[model samples]
Target: MSTASRIAIVTGGSRGIGRAVASRLAAAGQDVAVVYASNDKEADAAVGEIEAAGARGIALQADVADEAAVTAAFDTVERRLGPVDVVINAAGVMALQPTRELDLAELDRQLRTNVRGTFVMAKEAARRIRPGGAIVAFSTSITRLRFPTFGAYAATKGAVEALVPILAKELGGRDVTVNAVAPGPTATELFFDGKTQQDIDRIAAMNPMNRLGTPQDIAEVVAFLAGPGRWVNGQVVFANGGAA
Candidate 1:
């Protein structure tokens, strides 16, 4: 299929890495559906940006973990924009808490949004995305960093990493590609929240690039996977400036 007519769904597309990915895909000539859990204004703004990029765009709202909601979102995308050619599972939550003092409720919340959310979206994409499509899921480099307060967050992402290869195998006969993009320390709200500037600087220095990754950096990788990088399948691409 040609890029101009292709369709893509980006979960959590209202802000951060998801928004960047959605915009990048649209600019690459794909009609885009910008999905968000809340914040209709942000979602709408993202769609506007997509349209301004000369591609069709729409905004849909659904909690990533809600299977029914996500299914409906995909249905809406098909009805309005055509069959999905790419699905980016970028909806997730992150909280830093030491394992010993981790709150059970927090853990459950993270699992529901990160782990279960990826599963639900991937399942839906597997069913609906056309052949030659791609499914890009988000993961974190923290899984390898073994950061002190990142145990819970890293665990959820590890589950996501585990799912990528298995899902690729499950879709063996299909031309679709399944992969995960594991970004190291991107300068997104999720990464900035509850972090001191000192902490951020220290982490930035750890990367050979001596800077935190921008949303655009990660978006470029997603654009590649969603469009021309068909040869790359069933693997995790780390966009972390060689931090790992």
Candidate 2:
């Protein structure tokens, strides 16, 4: 990698794991453009953290599932930050319901953002990412754990995992890597949303680390995949701290 600062696009970057990844990339001297769904305040705060890390930062709002909006966001990044060197497709949504009683509307929402949004991001990345660049998408440890009530969420990510290697092979000889990070029970607002303290503790104890994964914990993996972890490509990394 050149000493010339690279640019990174982190979706869902207004909060949670995405925000942490943006900050980490910035600290490593990469300018980061955070693509958030909504919440102007949070997005601005995320940019502040990135800029405070001594890297350039910008916040752009877009619905990840909308192709036109996503495309426009990509154009804006290029116009302001230069060609994209890294894209972290971290935007996603989840609704916990038994597969038997699937909430059709919620399922659609998850599919739109998780599966379709990932595909959209991947498509843009495949077209725009510079050589030696990387495209990192988000998956969930629940996919491996077979958790109940995670059926729709896991389905979307399963598609993402399947897409990883196919896209990598398609981008053959491009010096770009396509990979995903399946994070375990991270301590994010999204994860803590419906669980009780006991539920959280039980899930945490399932892993050898004996605690919930943090946003920073997963951000480290994204930084590696998006930076110098070149030999690793077209694979889904279990960043779950020995969970499952």
Q: Residues 135-211, candidate 2, lDDT per residue (tens digit)?
A: 99999989999999999999999999999999999999999999999999999999999899999999999989899
Model 2 ranges off by over 4 Å:
2-4
Across 1-244, the per-residue lDDT of candidate 1 in tens digits comes to 3566899999989999999999999899999999898898999999999999999999998998999999899989989989899999999998888899999999999999999999999999999989999999999999888889899999999999999999999999899999999999999998999989999999999889999999999999999999999899999998999996
Model 1, 184: alpha-carbon shift in Å? Answer: 0.8
- Model 1 residue runs over 4 Å out of place are none
Where does candidate 2 have its weakest 10-residue lDDT segment?
Answer: 1-10
Backbone N/Cα/C clashes per model: 0, 0
**lDDT score of model 1?**
0.93
